[model samples]
Target: MSRYETVIGLEVHAQLKTKTKIFCSCSTEFGKDPNENVCAVCSGMPGVLPVLNEKVAEYATKMGIATNCEINLKSVFARKNYFYPDLPKGYQISQFELPICEHGHVDIEVDDEKKRIGVTRIHMEEDAGKSIHSAADNASFVDLNRTGVPLIEIVSEPDMRSAEEAIAYLKEVRSVLLYLGICDGNMEEGSFRCDANISVRPYGQEEFGTRAELKNLNSFKHILKAIKYEVDRQIDLVEDGEKVVQETRLFNVDKGITQSMRGKEEAHDYRYFPDPDLVPLVLDEAWVKQWQSELPELPRDKRERFMVEYTLADYDAALITTDRTVAEYFEAAVKAYNGEAKKVTNWVVGELLPFCHEVESEACDVKLSPEKLAALLTLVDDGTISVKIGKDIFRDLCESGDDPAEYVKAKGLAQMSDSGELEAMVDQVIADNPSEVEAFKGGKKKLMSFFMGQVMRLSKGQANPGIVTKMIQEKLS
Candidate 1:
């Protein structure tokens, strides 16, 4: 049997987070009643003129600049003719030949290797209305609220070799969009959706095999599964002497398989023509430079900075910079601690992160400020509080945002690091646990742990365990 390789490309439609619809004055709010947000312009009523939204163009330009794409100085919208009841317009206004961006690429890290995936084009388009189908009643309902919502469809070249690379590309693209604030990148609410074109070919073969388009993949997990299943299905079909047909398929997440929707249509099938209602969008180099200057330090740059400046490991840098809020929080904490990178990372990852997840709050909104957290860690470092006591105080600070120093003083949780005091405590503990002491003398070194625990309990968890253990070892010997 010959081994086959899978090749995949993705068309990611990310709904721009604008306040109003693309070509209308209606609110672009999601979750509204069906057709409530629709207007004559979005509904595709005859004689309705579609005025272009300037923000949409700015966002598209921003994405183009961010992805290192060639921004088309002039881009035009073309009507994509189709007859779907959900699309109030008999034709969807989309860009075909002259898209806003072309020949861009984003670098993605998959399995510790960096790969650049080529972006064929990023075009501006208006979304079609959603159709909800009922399984039991076999009826479909239309929601036009999403119709006319602005979107930038980022089409990637078929450069991905596996499902993992495809997912990494999707994640990097989504992260860039989110950081740019052009799109919210929420997959669940249809704000960000992906359609994958996947095919399988024999290893070392140059010609591409038959490809299937998988739609309705809302989440990253589903995209991976759907692509893998489709690849396997196509490879199996070729192995069984059956040809893989070119068709659009829907991924049934519940069933974990792709079902055929319709045969693929060529681009000319849509009868594309310039939209008469909308004029060509002419962007000057000055405007593109403005949006480019406003772009934030993207994920890759921030990740590298964290590693170099803060001495964070790759995983730590990656985690801290995954979201803007988390990244800012980590940076602020580091600044407060005078560049105690490891301590800041430990507190943020170990304590602040779990607390944020538990309370369903953002890390930026956590009660403890980075300054206070740094101060708390300083207390542990200076032996003002033991590590265990510092943890307790840190939890209190997280709950109340209290000053760590004040809390430690009020709670009497300061560490008893004075050698005289800790030594006396350890001696008392050994005298009290005579039998355990005998076990230690008889080579049951594990009893040392018991002695330390007793000392910690006696000190109310304020004794420095390191000092206590050393003193106990000297006394026993």
Candidate 2:
């Protein structure tokens, strides 16, 4: 219970996955040879008029609908005046007074308590180019390939109280964009980026402390660390009778501290005005409804549905729904095996995710497809193999891309479930380990694991573990 309460709001810029730059015919491919993908229009040569790309509007409106935002039928795009070497036009064209969407909300959970954060507006904009600095030579380079790329800036209300909430809100927005397929959601590649505005006030104070902008937080870990440090710095300033200043700050990755970059700018500072070259974007009600109906089920909705329909717990549902392909993979296996979602979830979350991590590939990219995973789980379900042997079988199937049933039969990995054969082995085990058996009968119940281990070792790791446990209990009792 500190005397201060932190307030946070996030602005996420998601570059839409359009084939071409928003207002030009230039290709939007990344990692092109520096300025290779640039054209006269994208590079902002004089006497060239901009033509709006319909796909940009389509993607932005789709995101608005997905985030439960109000779609402004007649949204205007304005010129945001700024002069930087990377901004080839000297002024970036963006939406201002009449943005494409407004009044949206995203719900997030922290410590199992749900909160709906308000989205103030979602506006369309064109991305500026990159500025490259050379290490060998003391010179700067500007690459205009990224200029004129379609972007939608999602502005959130200042509802977050801590780093966890801000991050949860950011992740939810990224997931929605990813699910929509409008954005690649790659933060490292600059496809998705966030700038946070943070402020603090006394616990019962009605006025807010001046906020500082935190920029260039590429990773989640960096974002979290930055917020924690910023909040503490503001609280300290207030306690020391120092007033916090409104300025832009950069998060230093190596030093793990935020340094002031520049003073925060207001909307009026951008000198926004409607572009005379381009007309207003007028979306009809029928057209907006069409895209709304076509929107995919978002991550949050999918997570909730999994909990109810698949009978999965909150943690499993969240883990599986973290990415679209992972959720699809889980659903495919469940459908193939005809239910048993809990078992499927356990394997997918416990086994599949880690395997994907080890290979440094997406879960959907694995050779172990849903059908194959279903087959492996079926082998365990039918008692053809024990869980221990299934581990080996799963690994072999992944490595060799072989069918599970064939692999089991070819490798002699089937669980030996025969009672008579197992009983004889149990007798041999009990007879050989007299001291352990005596210890087991002398009220040492925990020694059952030792007997089970010996039986497994004697059976060459093919013994049915459940049957071994039963036989050991019968003999010991």
Candidate 3:
């Protein structure tokens, strides 16, 4: 424990999945040739004017409703003036005075304690282009393809007291975006990114200390590392009687330290003014109601429901409900199996999830369907195949999408449950391991596992464990 308390707030930029740019008709598709998606409006031509994309408003409003925000009936767009090579337009259009959403909050759990973090606002804006630097040529290039892309910046209050709480809150927000199907939530591709503002003060101080904004935090690992490093730096400066300056710093991935980028600017520095071309956006009541109706069950609600409906433990329910697709997959598998929900939960969480992760795909996109997985589990339920054998062939079934019963029959991998055959195998194992048998009869009952291991090896993992255990006990007794 330290004498200072850490305060953290996150600003997240999530690129909306729209077919075209926010203010222009140019396609928003990524990974095309340089300037392939550019147009007169997006390129900032002299005579072009921007038109708001209706779909962008709908998406933003839906997010606001999902976060328990108050959807303002009318909002204004203002020009955020700045100078950069990637920003072709001298001023980027963003909302400042009255955003579309305000006064919202989301709940998160850290260390088994639930906390609600305040969402100050979620506002819409246009994204700037990319700047690519070529070391060989000793030059930098700008690609305007990403210019005019739609984004919503969710700003959180300084409600987090530690990095763990900040991360938990971020994950909760990302999960909501994913569940709403409004954003792709891809951190590596820049579709989803974060900027963290950190400050430190004495444990009882009410006033906040000078803060530093950290940028270039691409992934969660980098965010966590940056927060930890920045917190310590601020504390050291305070203890040494040095002032912590307010500025923007970039996190160097290799060095794992923050380097000052530039002095942080206040809103007045930008000279913000209402855009002359675009008018105030007034949302219709019916339109807002329609979006509200279409909102799907959020992650937290679904997680609680899974616990009561399926009798799942908290860990299993939380893992399954983290993503909407995985939850749907679990429900579909359970419906098809019509057996113990826990049994289906075990296979889905233990086997299917790992396989999907290894192949880099979602639960819905995996080659193995829920029905096929239920079929595989059914074979084990009926004693037609051993549990070990089912696990061994799971990967192959996921890849090939073969029928479980047919594959078991074709490969001669059925469990050895016949009385005479199992008895003989058990007898041979006892005769071979006489010392182990004597040990078991002499009260080293744990040796029963050793006998079972031998029988399983002899039968090539196809032995019925229950029957083998019974026969080994009788012979030894």
Highest lDDT: give the candidate number. 3
* Residue 406 local lDDT, model 1: 91
Q: What TM-score does each of the candidates earn?
A: 0.91, 0.95, 0.97
lDDT of 1 by residue, 1-477 (tens): 439988898999999989998888889988888789988899878887888889999999999989999999999999999889888878999999999999999998887999999999999999999888989888988888889999999999999999999988998898889889888788888899999999999999999998999986899999989988898899889999999999999998899999999998779889999988788899989998889899999988999998999899988888778777788888887888864689889878888888887887777777888888888888888889887777766666887988999988998878888898888888889888889888898999888889989998888888888888888888887
**Reference-based lDDT, each prediction:** 0.88, 0.91, 0.92
How badly does each model clash, as a count of residue pairs? 0, 0, 0
Clashing pairs in 2: none
Per-candidate RMSD vs. true structure? 2.7, 1.8, 1.3
Q: lDDT per residue, candidate 3, 1-477, as tens digits?
A: 899999999999999999999999999998999999999999999988899999999999999999999999999999999999999988889999989999999999988899999999999999999999999999999999999999999999999999899888888898899999989888998988999999999999999989999975778888888999999999999999999999999998899888899998889999999988899999999999999999999999999998999999988988888888999999999999968999989998898889888997788987678999999999998899988999999998888888889999999999989888888889898889888888899999988889999989988988899988888877778
Shift in Å, residue 18, candidate 2 = 1.1
Q: What is the lDDT of residue 66 in candidate 2?
A: 87
Worst 10 residues of 3 by lDDT: 215-224
Candidate 2: 10-residue stretch with minimal lDDT:
391-400
